[model samples]
Target: MYGVNTYADTNFASITLDNDVFVGKDNGYTNGLYFSLYNVGVGLRPNFWVSPLLWTMPRGYAENRINVHSIGQTLTTAEDITQANPPEGSLPYSGLLKYTNTHIVVGSRFTDWVSTSVGIVGPAAKGKQTQTEFHALIGAEKPMGWDTQLKNEFVFGFSRGRAIRVLASRSDTMDLLAGGQLSVGTISSGVNAAIMLRLGQNLRDSYPTVSLASSRASNPIAVNNSWFVYAGVSANYVFNQIFTDGNTFRDSRSIDYDHNYNTFMTGITYTIGRDSSLSFAYLSSFSDDDTEYSRQTERLNRFGTLTLVWEF
Candidate 1:
């Protein structure tokens, strides 16, 4: 929750799950698991790598600042995972294991975030084992082509963005927010912007970071009880995508990926007490203009997210 301006100094933890199963699909970004610690004493020392950004933190009006560390894994596969060798021009199998650190600042009506992540993709990420075993446990069809997945590669990424409250209803029960983000790295590179319309109570208790910014969870700490339902849309321009572009250093399964797309999402959040919240969201994507890769994997782009945040 970056724009609350009066947030308390407390620690929080969260778990987020993203899966296509809820939408009755089994391939293409099939599953994701993430965990985060917010404002906890992780003792992140300032170093040459991050000092400049640290110096940029706004003063005076900036009322809240928090550090967040997160670790997560995401899995993607071709449309047909059961095949020993998937068809040509389909999504390739890949998995990512990532750890990120984010610096957040909240001002009178604006929130800003700067984040960096390090990760690996390929066998080292254990995408094959995680997916196959989970499927076996659930009695689902096993994915057989992980052997042909992307080769191992290390990835580094950085992103910075800001979201601001642009409008609010007289009663303070409805608001509209907008923001833009830019990212670059070996994993992927892109720029995106989104607008969200929210309706609920205590709208100032927290900011919209989850579905709006593609972050995994909302703020865990709240000033008081709060709840909201939101719908949002984002447009993106991707310069590169390692998953569909194949291994960064080696030739491997890959596709002529789409470079532009849009996402639409709707969700609701409910606060329990003043220190916990649960959220559920459904999201889907589409190419701005019909493209081969987009058309091929169109049905595989819908997914759902469930996140729980609580005080530590």
Candidate 2:
């Protein structure tokens, strides 16, 4: 939610005996699950109050659970990453960079088209502290394109306290967002964006952030039962991803220079059963500006992910 951008920092990290590498607060993995808790966490309301109508129009909560895995290269310097071949001390020049993340989310559908959710997220095994996130969302599936089969959805939400390590309080934002999604035959795609309007001691007014993801579940194969495979790509463009990282390597987030250039993602998912599925993906960021001049950039190396899901 809040730290989805590079400027938004989290205090999470991990290292294993087998592969002693640093996996920062987040592995740079982004999720793209259809039944994702975020699909309706803050449910489309620009306002925070719950609608009294929802109480009378809805039944009881319909619960479900899911887990997501993310993997990618470690965060390295812009120089090292850009080099064709890094020197010896820069050992990770190749694939030594690996990051894994796991997320467990619990969601409930309050109405046929509305849901609310909360979740605990952490490293797959090592680094940083844990984080919690919650949200409410609402959407309607209707034809968005000329093709009647291309059902589209308009969704909106609000999320807060996503990083247990930072702003655990509701003081700053993690506030609002809205977007559009489409389901067409064997494919689905979405684009969502947000802007931080409310200013705080730890935050700066930022430009609107945007992200896009898409998947296709077309390859079919039958083993124990019918199964299908899908692949997708996603990208996030954020301004000032880390707003307050006053450090030696970097300091002070500014719109003129410091901002998240972009993070790119690609992955595959498989439906093994009616209620179970699996997915794997990779990520890389390009914010590598190491200059004091305005309009410069900085970047993070690479990372990846794996996700397991089950729903009812």
Candidate 3:
């Protein structure tokens, strides 16, 4: 048996300032905090051919609190005042919240040409306002020739609102994923690429929104009929018994919540001796919303990650 654990904490802050020849003071500032915990465990077969089983768990929390002030009076929904000159007032809004998640997964490979895995995920606490989700997935691949390969996968899952009643509203929503890949040149050292697509949906609930109306209610909106596409490329090199591979990456993990979008990533790996190696990767997302009110239309958000691994 093998096990590992890690923890991390990070903070971000920003400020902006403007000075005009004939205007009131103009400046703004914002700040945020993030914390995380991660853990993993594994068991291996002595022969290294029967395969191994691994499990992983991670948890994170983030909060954004901001305040804005202007030398001029800004019109609130309650104000009907017109202004030819800067108004004399300040308007500020701030928010604070925390979230927790729990995950359990089991995976194994049967041979060099085929593999499969599945998992269950949900929140650990009750009375918490968060979506509880469950997922199951399986995948397989086979060598098509000396220089090419084919693969396919399928995923089905469901997400529930804050209460059990919301979960029972449906038999459990469904999702699907399928894909394939191909390579050119030497089977052991060359270039390769793959494309994958995903489709899924979620149930409706009492979500929040900002509108001119004083009250909001839950409505039956179409849940499902969303689709996503991902593509990536990689290069591999081998010298004697040592080898290395690097690849551009892509993913659509958050497409269901943020609307259809795409992410790009790149990574590198080096093999040492015959049965062990290390690798690192980075990923980022891009906007694809067509509507003016979508979050991606207002601001661009990006993320970066690093990973290391050893195999035997």
TM-score of candidate 1 to 2 decimals? 0.90
**Which pairs clash inside model 3?**
73-87, 249-265
Instruction: Tell me how candidate 3 scores on lDDT.
Output: 0.18
Instruction: State the displacement of the C-alpha of residue 268, model 3, in Å, after optimal TM-score superposition.
Output: 5.3
Report the C-alpha lDDT of model 3 over 1-312, residue by residue, as the tens digit. Answer: 011110122111111111110122111111112222222222211122112211111112111111111011100110111222212221111111222221222111000111111211111111011101100121212111111101111211111111111121242232121212121211112122212121122312100000000000100112122111212322212211000110112121111123333444333333334322232333334445544323321122122222222222
Q: Worst ten-residue run, lDDT, model 3?
A: 207-216
Off by over 4 Å in 1: 1-7, 40-60, 208-223, 296-301
Q: Sorted on lDDT, highest at the top, how do the candidates line up?
A: 1, 2, 3
Ranking 1 against 3 by lDDT, winner: 1
- From the highest TM-score down, the ranking of the candidates is 1, 2, 3
Q: How displaced is residue 46 in candidate 2, in Å?
A: 12
* 10 residues in a row with least lDDT, candidate 1: 40-49
lDDT against the true structure, per candidate, is 0.74, 0.23, 0.18
Taking the tens digit of each residue's C-alpha lDDT, what string does model 2 give over 140-187? 121111111111212222111111111212643232222222221111
Greater lDDT among 1 and 2 belongs to 1
